[model samples]
Target: MDLQAAEKRTKELHNLLNKYNYEYHVLDNPSVPDAEYDALLKELVDLEETFPALKTSDSPSQRVGGEILDMFQKVQHHSPMLSLGNAFNEADLRDFDRKVRQAIGDSFSYVCELKIDGLAVSLRYVDGLFELGATRGDGTTGEDITANLRTIRSIPLRLNEQVSIEVRGEAFMPKKSFEALNKAKDENGEEPFANPRNAAAGSLRQLDPRIAASRNLDIFLYAIGDPGETGVRSHSQGLDLLDDLGFKTNKERQRCASIEDVLQYVEGWQEKRPHLPYEIDGIVIKVDSLEQQDELGTTAKSPRWAIAYKFPAEEVVTKLLNIELSVGRTGVLTPTALLEPVKVAGTTVKRASLHNEDLIREKDIKIGDSVVVKKAGDIIPEVVNVLVERRTGEEVDFLMPTHCPECESELVRIEGEVALRCINPKCPAQIREGLIHFVSRNAMNIDGLGERVVSQLFQEKLIEDVADLYKLTYEQLISLERMGEKSVANLLNAINASKSNSLERLLFGLGIRHVGSKAAKTIAMEFGNMDKLANATREDLTAINEIGDKMADSIVAFFEQEEAAELIQELKDSGVNMEYTGARPVAAEESDSVFAGKTIVLTGKLEQLSRNEAKEQIELLGGKITGSVSKKTDIVIAGEDAGSKLTKAEQLGIEIWDEEKLLEELKG
Candidate 1:
């Protein structure tokens, strides 16, 4: 067929397939048979293959899959993805209602939505075409997963109207899909995912879009990124707008006129949660009016206008068979309770974390005791308490092991820490855990190299350290059990790609004591590279604002170790990138701006800049932006509809600036 004919045919097929997909997935009504849809899709695919240039990003055929990505890029959210404060009971719900009423008066209603037990994501559309999709990483910044999100058929490639907007949603796996996936995994002798939420998150994080496409994942858009831009006056209207734009939204949502109505909805859903095809951990209640929401504003981490009412965790009684101990990568010993097989929250519970010796003693948990087991967040099975009254003198108190379970070294408790530590640098368990951390998603992020793979490599003596991973041969990997040619190739590709990661990832993966991901990023930016960081003294490190004395000491002590020095050299020889490639914060000494050396707190609805944008600019001018107002805060930037922070700043006698003043200062 000619190019013009192929293009025409592809366009027609796209329109047809999009309509059919919407009917089946969104509307829950299939207008055509699966076979007919498949035929049309196949035709479009063929046409696209013939006329490659005619293939567009929004074409229905693109929903199937795309090329594998090397790494997910970081995306800055235009608006912060603030989490909701939780309400666990009717009283908590009433408290939330009271708070809302106190802030915005009793005239406001609420919109209650089922909080899907899945990963939170942000989707951005440009001129009605889906442009970007991202994981909610740190609320402000997230990982770009546009390719993987495109595979979900329910997500519209192009909206009905040409509008640029950003929306928040939960990406999930249906119960049927999760069951089928677990069944297949079980049949293949592979470990199944703990729950549908985890399965969905894992599937969406796949570097290969094809993997995500095959998972049968779905999304329910809940909120708009900016309601004012959409001209939506309330939360319910925002959801309606999403639906009108051909986006999938949960039909279970309802507008509650009062707290009693909200309570009724919550109770009804809690009882019916088990019968649903998807998982919901809680109900999200939000003040319906956008103007009221603005008035209520937000805290540092959560929105004041919204609250999540979590369902009571399902609990079951089980016999405590025994307790097992294990050493983690940090040399900290942890205890696990071995329970008699019992079902809890739809999963069989045989084990639960005991946390530490102190917790075990505090709870007075004894072996062979009847205990209440409940899944925390409907994911992890945990022992709530022991039924000491039911004990028939058979239960024996569990003693904390004096020695390390793996290395047989004497365990010692640190000065300020609770967990018993082995303190053995060469401990096998610690080494194995370290290797796993090195390949973790937030670290080197080597795809196809999970904990199991890391364990296998450690057991085979093929890898001793993170550096050894770069030296792996195809022959050695291919000889390992379950390592097929394709799998080996993918692993090798992932390993090769990881060599290019920024210094912060390497710092976090190194497992430096007391240094978390955020601290690593801060230190990496401060020093710029591994060489400088290694040479940095405690004083040098402590000079940086975020690095505390403990962190500084830890970093200095780590770099002073001969083994640590050798490891850095080995990693450097393996061609790993050690430089901080990301944008660094402006130095206070280098800036003459008015915001220099000032600790600024921002609050309320900014008409000019989003919270993040304002914060970034403030920091760039050498100002430190904190979340809350305190005696230490030098300036509080109050925008239109300023809330509690503004009031608090005024009460504290802290200097406050409006948006115009902030803008003027920024200009100067």
Candidate 2:
């Protein structure tokens, strides 16, 4: 094909695919089947391959994300992505109403819109074309995710208005997309995302935008960041402007003249939320007048001018037929309230988290009590209230055992800790839980291993600890009940593959207290390997910023055990990524380490490394990359706006750099 013809064909294919993506994801109205969409996408890929030079980086093919990034690059937001104040109950909502009334004197109306259950993102348009998009990191700064954001068809790459403006929106993975993604992950021996929010967040963070594109994310524009040049008088007007600008604003938005109308709107959605395509966490009620919003201002965490009236967690009553305590990988005692099966938020709730002993006492919960249960954030189910009035005298007051219910070990509640823990490293329950976690998708991510399979392995004496999982034979696995030959082969393949997961994943799967994924990643990058990390003192750990004292103590305690030592040796022998070969000196020791003390600000989109890769590069150079642009920044890898940081860097005379310059330095 000729150059012009190919270019036109590319545009045509992109538009067609984007339209189908919108219908399936944004509109929940799929005109073409998934198979048809995939076929068109395949054709687009073939065409792009044939005319590789004609393909733009923002083309839909770039979404799936690139190689696993070692760290995330930091970008300062052009505008502060402020959070909204929350109202948990009716009284809280009334108080917010009173505050708004006090400020505007009941004359100003409010715009009530659904508070979407998704990550907040800010998009910048320069001369009516999408230039950048980012997360709501630290409010003042975020990661530049323009490449990923452009993949969302609902988000127009080029606006009709020739204006520079920033728009705030919620980036969410549609329920159907989430389900499909999770299903695929499950089949691929990967860990499934817990919810749509997690799925969306993870997908967008991928270095390759193609991964994000494949996830079928959609968004709803809510607020206009730069009202400059646009003569908008009210929040409602701002919504109109966004809609006119070809942004997908929520249809549930309403203009309520009084607080009563606002309350009615919130009440109506309490039941109507489930009918929507995406998840709505609550209702955001904002003072409509732009002038009034300025007067009301904000608190440190959220804006006072707007308040989110959160719906009470959707609740349904179920009988607490049994109270079961299970030991976690970290040896914490978790009580599960096995309930009489009931439906909540489209899923059947057979069990709910009983929290800890304090929760049981506070709720005055007992065996035989009918309890109210609901899914928090349409995810984990938990008991909300106990039906004390419905309790017959025959109902027994449940006493949470002071011992490890599984291994009879004495339980101890550490100060400032809510959980009653079984500190015995060798406790059977703890070992079982640890094994489960180790093989879990998020951690080692071994495939074909569910709780049932793990239990069967243990019962049949084929496995004991997590290490035993790797030693299992296909023959032994096939012998287990219902383990078909194909299933066993797939399971074995997954177990074999998990021997080399990155150090961060292995650390988090270990289930150390106060050590979440972010913490684990930080530690993995800092120590570079398990051996050094295991040997580090509390002071050494505390020196790294973001690692708190509690976490340091937990690390100290975890590594002190003989079992931890044994596990480490076993994992090393099993060929896990046991050392820090990847997280150091970006230029193979050729460049001086002066970049160590100098932080760089990443702005705009880079075709090279992802935000995560950029952050890792800076860190490896013995330097730090902070999310915000500050006087301390040595250089700003200015991409697009670079926002306030670019302005601040200019003001501070900090060395400014771009993605190409940084890449060139790395190559050196």
Query: Scored by CA lDDT, what does every candidate get?
Result: 0.87, 0.77
Relative to the true structure, candidate 2 reaches a TM of: 0.49
* Candidate 1 TM-score over all chains jointly: 0.53
lDDT of 2 by residue, 294-338 (tens): 888878888888888877666899899988887866666777898
Q: Give me the candidate number with maximum TM-score.
A: 1
Per-candidate TM vs. native? Answer: 0.53, 0.49
- Residues 1-668 of candidate 1: C-alpha lDDT, one tens digit per residue: 89888877877888899899887788665546566888888888888788889889899888867899999999999899988889999999999889888877889888999999999999999999999999999999999999999999889999989999999999999987897776444323244576799999999999999999888999999989998998889999999999899999986778899999999999878866765678999999988889988899899999999999988777999999999987888787878999999998777889998777877887899999999999854666778898989999988889888888888999988765567888898898999999998899888899999999999999999999889999999999999999999999999999999999999999999988777777899888888999999999989997775576767988999999999999999999999999998765676778899898787888777898988789888888888876556567789999876755787899899999999999899889
